[model samples]
Target: MKTPTSPIVAPVALLTSAVLLTSAALLTACSSMGGTSQKFDQASVPESVRVPAGHKVAWETTGRGLITYECRDKANAPGMVEWVFVGPQADLWDRAGRKVGTYYGPPATWEAMDGSKVTATQLAVAPAGEGNLPYQLVKANPAMGSGAMQGVTYIQRVALKGGVAPAMACTMAGKGQRQTVGYQADYIFWKS
Candidate 1:
């Protein structure tokens, strides 16, 4: 009593499915490693990192660093509650490969070799990807340190590579376990 399906309909459906899949694959490829690299766009920066009416990018540096994750509960007890991102401790370098500064986060700071440092608190966040670390937008201000970071207005973390916490399970008994993953990013400093 059921009508037979049309042979032409099946082929059209298959072709449509293939095209959709192909489009998805292309999008994923654009965001994947060895596919595309990240670049800074001033207009698109997070609100916290966006410069005020007149200020411009005063300085920028590229850094090679590691993001540290601690497996601790809410009360600082040494068991796996969640993979809390402690922050990054990285060595900053210039375009010519010269060591320029260092970045430390969670109490986010950028310190230059001459002892100038700026610290900021995150105001916004963006996920770089599921497997990669999240990018942050911070409001930076002068801290104890001197030179490069003294008068900074903001700091933006972008172009994240690696740094996600491991999938390893942490039990309640495994309280003090700490994991550090390698990552690299570019930090842009805005100043008037």
Candidate 2:
């Protein structure tokens, strides 16, 4: 024999479940909206990726990284990056979220973790985000690492966000101390 309350219990349980599901969805949506990826604009992709009249894009790498600076004071020069250490080191990840290589430079270089590296020279520059370095067009030297970067003709660093020179002026007193700042940018690789 069915209890008088069984039918009522079923309906109430269904309604409660519906309410909980709706609330969970709303929270998920809100959390996604707060992410940094929301601020990224594809249209703002740096022109450093563009090649000469006939060339095309060989490959492109997009990733976030730290703009590392070590405390440095060279001869107490006028207004140099006194807190400069090795060029920044940024881990470059592929679309699959796998770390395939690293972009580290001041001399501006890229190294594939698998075993290849290339150095690039800045050819042109334009400003990017508030605290970031300038968007730069560069030309890469031959690849030394024997990996993916071989035969890379041109390289560009652009859409940078946060790789600024150190805030405090580096002095002889502060020499040898290291500092790392957070930064993100797009690295474009072009071949001849």
Candidate 3:
């Protein structure tokens, strides 16, 4: 009774609805993590350490030395969250860049500064209790990315030892005041 196009249209409509529903669900999940109630004890940072723009940089003391926290705005495209780690070679960056890992929502891709895409083996998030990392919503050019695109709020986080810090050169496309991404826990280590 129905034409071929009629049946096709029904499936197409159903698919479209499904995509919308999935996107909404993912967004809800990411939003639940972004809250201001979370807090962390202050870390001792040297007076000479400079915090970069878009970077909510902070540090705290443990016992001997200290560990630092640096978080950029959230890069909440329709798909997933991405972070840029720039510091020592043995930390999360080097370990994660070598393997391909999958998340619940989408497949994550890590790219190097030279345009080569690296595989992230271990994607470990902080907020070390029993919950997901607090994530804010942001947007950016999908093809170009945070450092290359305009008109998007891309979030990022990096780990640093001692005084070494990540690069602070990324193109941000928004006029809103930046806020602290979330609470974090860092392991402090002393230089030998």
Candidate 4:
């Protein structure tokens, strides 16, 4: 026969167990939201990854990954936006086996070394009735029958194992025409 206090102890134990289980569940949910596999945020991005002018990027992943990015502005021009991959330059050797000229390497493969990845693409936009601007500038010589050129569009994609929050910007390329814009995106991934 158990004492009255024994019954009380059993109930207290059951309640404690329930609370611990609930706390564990909550922690798991929060971790999923804050993992590295999630999208990127301006506050979270490193200054080194920002897009530079006249550079095209391509991001890829072998197993799984996620990336978040933003651009100031993107407008279309006359020519198609040319995304390119280049190789390194060869160095000329002097008679003394000295190095000369620049030794450039092939275009870098935008791959994540840590089994993760992210990428962005820019597009073009025109004014009221100007129409869709070309993604690339065909010819920029007024003497050659060209008026003005525009910029390309902006695109960014983030892939992660859990969650992500990414942002990007867009703008027009012209005197007093460029305007900065902001963007946001979310993505998720799961394994079998």
Candidate 5:
């Protein structure tokens, strides 16, 4: 014995299944493209610079910019000259190649396109290599204005490339001279 099926019921069921399948496919694609479920590996990172447990990555961006250094007298060492870090000026971009924000300051601030911003204190650092800046972990202060930076607890700077101070002599004659060097790094934001 066969029960007759309603024409409307059959089409509705098929449409619902198709929508579900499309959603699932989209989710899978997002994850593969560095979505929320993407895991950040820290196995090769020094223990000192690794993010603490109980936190997960909330955002990730590639920062490409210039780091300025100034030739000045060495602190506490009169007559000795050295390059001192001035600050950084950089643009942040997401994995999708969209420009999202800026990072600049003597206070190390990260600002989002939505006007949300955060300043951080360095927690630890580990050497990356010669001629490269060290990998770093920073503790973020409470975000101001509440957007992308809200609830961010930590920030890790990794995959460093070329931010070291200029190698030219910081002699007395070169005092106060400023040099800007190019750099690129991945900044991973974490939340508890």
Candidate 6:
């Protein structure tokens, strides 16, 4: 004979399981929302591209998009041609996978959704690996408009993939041609 409480016991157990699963998911979401919770080991980064002492991570983003290259006459080489980098056009996303801003330019710029933006000067670069763009460090110019990008001091480009110039022949016939290659990199912003 079945006890009166047996059906109640099964429903209670199912409810408890559902609550536990929801709690775990919420915890995971909360952890990822704090973008800086993703570890950035300074020691692993080349010193040339590392942020200096006294600066802390202000924002971390993953940039994904295209880098345009043009086939042009090699600088100072009268008859030789080569693929030259034009600029990058990329969307920057936060750790939680939200689109936060954009990176583009002849003057490399990072602009946030709130209208604040910054232009940076390249400070240094180190080899990332074969077929990958080099890691870079840049000093941030004073941000304009005062939102998410305001007060940023430096930016580091790491975890590079692709972005190199096209491997095709840059001959006289190909001169003036342009091509875009896809790339992804992590941009870590720092504040003093």
How good is model 6 by TM-score? Answer: 0.85
Give each model's whole-structure lDDT: 0.75, 0.71, 0.30, 0.28, 0.92, 0.92
Model 2 TM-score is 0.64
- Candidate 2 or 1, higher lDDT: 1
lDDT of 5 by residue, 9-35 (tens): 999999999999999999998776656
Task: Return the top candidate by TM-score.
Answer: 6
Candidate 4, position 31, lDDT: 65
Stretches > 4 Å off in candidate 6: 1-25, 32-37
Query: Per-residue error at 25 for model 3, in Å?
Result: 1.3
- Report the C-alpha displacement of residue 99, candidate 1, in angstroms: 1.0
Window of ten residues with lowest summed lDDT in model 1: 31-40
Minimum summed lDDT over a 10-residue window in model 4 is located at 133-142
List, residue by residue over 1-192, the lDDT tens digit for candidate 1.
999999899999999999999999988965573235334577665455455576667666787878888877856554337767788899997654679888887677788899988778677877776777677777876557657777788777776788888678755666568888888887887877
Candidate 6 least-lDDT 10 residues: 32-41
Report lDDT (Cα) of residue 79, candidate 2: 50
Worst 10 residues of 2 by lDDT: 34-43
* lDDT per residue as tens, model 2, 78-118: 55546555677788865445677887767777888778889
**lDDT value, candidate 5, whole model:** 0.92
Residue 93 error for model 6, in Å?
0.8
Position 20, candidate 5: lDDT: 100
Superposed on all Cα atoms, model 1 deviates from the true structure by an RMSD in Å of 16.1
Q: What are the per-residue Cα lDDT tens digits for candidate 3 across 1-192?
A: 964676588899999999999999988866564432233322333222222235331211111121222344546654332233322222221121222211111233323333432222222333312332321112212423333112222323322223222233322442132222222223221111
Model 4: per-residue lDDT, tens digit, 1-192?
964676689899999999999999988876664333433342332333233354332211122222222222223654322222222122222222333212123221121123222222222221211221111111111111111111211222222122122222222332222222222121111111
